[model samples]
Target chain A: MAARSLGVVGARVVVVAAAAALWELVTRLAAQPYFPAPSTIVPRMYELWFSGPVTHVFLTDDALDTFPPSLGRLLVGWVAASLAGIVLGLAIGRSRVLSDFLDPVIDFGRAVPPPMLVPIFFALFRIGTPTQIATIVFGVIWPVLINAVDGAATVDRQHLETAKVFGLSRPQVIGRIIVPSAMPKIVAGLRLSLSLALIMMVISELVGSTSGIGYRLMTAQQNFLITDVWGCIVLLGVLGYLLNSSFLLVENRILGWHSRARQNA
Target chain B: MLEIIDVTHTYGAYQALGGVKLTLAEGELVCVVGPSGCGKSTLLRCVAGLVQPTGGRILLDGVPVSQTPDNLAVVFQDYSRSLFPWMSAAANVALPLRRKGMDRASRRTAAMEALEQVGLAGAAGKYPWEMSGGMQQRVSIARALAYRPSLLLMDEPFGSVDAQTREDLEDLVLRVCAHHGMTIMLVTHDIDESVYLGDRVVVLSRSPGTVAGDLQVSLPSPRDQIATREHETFVRLRAEVGRLIRGNQLSPQET
Candidate 1:
């Protein structure tokens, strides 16, 4: 197993290297101003973002100006949406009255595209971090809510009966039984929302915002600095990849029991 | 003490149980036997307060059981679903004790002791899926034991395991009842198991079931699987319970 995984990693590295080489060759030979070669883009990216004192962790002034606010907004919005979604989802899922009342409303809201709501959110909050955060939370909350509802609703009959027989209180039943029972679904929803949160983060910034990667991408494009535009795109891609990888790492650790149990079954 | 006073339950138009009556004294082990769909499980559920009968009532220690009673636990047949997969064996056992107001350390100690009672001390840290079906059932039994309930209900608890495992679990139940002095009402379709495990066997009629017969088990104490099965009294009682069950199967529905 160890050797097989190592071989897979080796193949991934080779494919990435070959792809980069091909892109570099094509762009340089074509010499199109619209598509800068990786060679020039790499130097500009390094100078813009990574050249700084050791104390600043190699972040230049532009890097400090751009990365933190965007990341902070993304994280804050995502966490808020996750917390609200799970709480509301569990309530709606477990209660017949609440579900009956809210199901149609949730369905209608989830159907509308999130990007289209950005203008409305901007009108409500008026072009600032609030608007951006509002846009992100609205866009990403549905997956978490839908999945949590499904998870909490479908808890096994035996588990619930056992909990009842033991005379568990409402909180004890929810905390000890329902939440853990619903975790596999909850985690799936969280992972899906994380990717959606990243997309929403960019879209929110692309329309309005002063200092984010998305803002940087817009300015670079308007200035016709095509290489910087490419740099911003590459940065967003790296950010998305890192966020997803880290999320998976945490998920695997916490949900090890779920997968193992599934295998056993 | 537990008493069922003419319990009747229906699911929509279909009656699951009809006018069933029984009683269990403190520290008694009674096995309820019947054919499939005979409402043996429904009867157990009514007593455990998992289901409320449409008519009649259950009283635990002179108090009417509208909700699940204190100091009560159930060991369900589907151990895989009953035991929480996310929790370790010890954690599952310890979960109910939170209601007992046990501190974390004491809960852990009590859970360990219960697991040891079920002969699963070494498997305390393992999750339910990591163990065999019999082992998982043992964990569930340990959970009930840790709760130290005044009453324990088993609804076909050994039905899902292999024959050998079922025998081993039967003996384990007997030993736990003796050791803990817990009042138990075990439901099963296996007639021989009813005789082997219970101090008395109560047979129920087919669907919309009612008590058909009740017989005392006179086998020797500290029952051995081989010796108890070979005993004349044991054989006679098993045959009697079997006859009662088969007779109920052939009879017409009684109101």
Candidate 2:
């Protein structure tokens, strides 16, 4: 298994390198102002992020300021949305009445685009961190909420009967059988929501925020710093990839049985 | 002891069960046999108080069973769904014990003991999905055993297993029931199994399931799959019960 995963990682590295080499060649030939070669972007990324004093731990002031706030906003918003989504999802999923009554409302909220809500939220909370956080929270909560509801609602029928026959109380049933059964799907939903949270984080800051990776990208664009813009894009991609891998580490541990079962099958 | 008196159940306009009456004495192992779509599962659910019969009542120890009684447990037909896949086998058994206010340590001890009883002590730490169909079913049985209920209801518990595994499970049930003197109502469509495991066999008709016949088995205990099946009493009882079930007639005088 370890050898197989190693091979997979090796192949992925080759693919990425090949793509970068092709991009560098095409852009050098074209010599476009908007499109910098991979070589330019790599050194510029290093200069922008780690061009500070050697004693300063390989991070510049811009890196320290922009990266942390973006990360902080993403984490806080995602965590809050996840918890609230699961709790509310479980409650709504378990009851036929509440789910029915709230169906139309949930549909409406999910239907509205995240960018469309940006203006509405800007009016409510002003152009600041609050608006940024709210936008992300609003955008990412739906996938987790809807999937959690589906997962909780569709727990195997026999398991519910077994719970009843065993004399487990309503709360006990929900906590033990319902939630655990729903966990795999909930984790899947969480993964989708995580990516959405990253996207929403950038979109939220695009119009209002003073600091963030997105704002930095916008600033670089306005200043015609083409290499910095490419560098920031690469940085965002790496950050997104790292965040997703971290979530997977936890997910694999939680749903280890499910993955093993699928592999054997 | 439990009593199902004049129990009638309907699903919308369709009558699934009509006047199904049964009386189970203390420490009795009864097998309920019937054809397909006979509502045998519904009867077990009604007994467990998981479903309400449209008419009459189920009385456990002279008390009407409107809700699931504290001392009753059921092993559902689908072991894959009944056992929580996320939990270890022992944890699955221990989950029901949580409501009884047992602490974690005691519940673990009891779960281990119950798993030991079901010959699945080594499987305690394994998840249900990690095990085979038969092993998963054993875990479900262990869970029911761990509950230490006064009455146990098994709804087609061994229907999904192979023939050899089915016989092994049947003997396991017999051994466990004899050892604990636990009252059991096992639902099955297999004829030989009904006589093999049950002290008494109750036959039901198709569709609107109701008591068609009840036969007492005088066959000796410590029954072997081969020897007991070949025994004269086992053969005679099986044949009689088979005829009665096929006939769809309640003839107590004939038995």
Tell me chain A's TM-score in each of the predictions. Answer: 0.95, 0.96
Cand 2, B chain, TM: 0.96
TM-score of 1: 0.96
Q: Give, for candidate 1 chain A, the lowest lDDT window spanning 10 residues.
A: A175-184
- What C-alpha lDDT, on a 0 to 100 scale, does residue B223 get in candidate 1? 93
Top lDDT model:
1
The alpha-carbon lDDT assigned to residue A77 of candidate 2 equals 93
Candidate 2 docking band: medium
Candidate 2 residue spans exceeding 4 A from truth: A53-56, B249-255
Candidate 1 structure quality by residue, lDDT tens digits, A166-255: 878899889988888888999999999998988898889998789888899889989998999999988888899999999999999989
Model 2 per-residue lDDT tens digits across residues A1-265: 8999999999999999999999999999999989999999999998889888777788899889898889898999999999989998887888899899987898998998988988988899988888888999999999999989999899888888888889899888888889988898899999999999999998887887899998998888889999998998898899889989999999989999878766654
lDDT of 1: 0.92
* Candidate with maximal DockQ: 1
In the predicted model 1, the residue pairs found to clash are: none
lDDT at A170 for candidate 2? Answer: 85
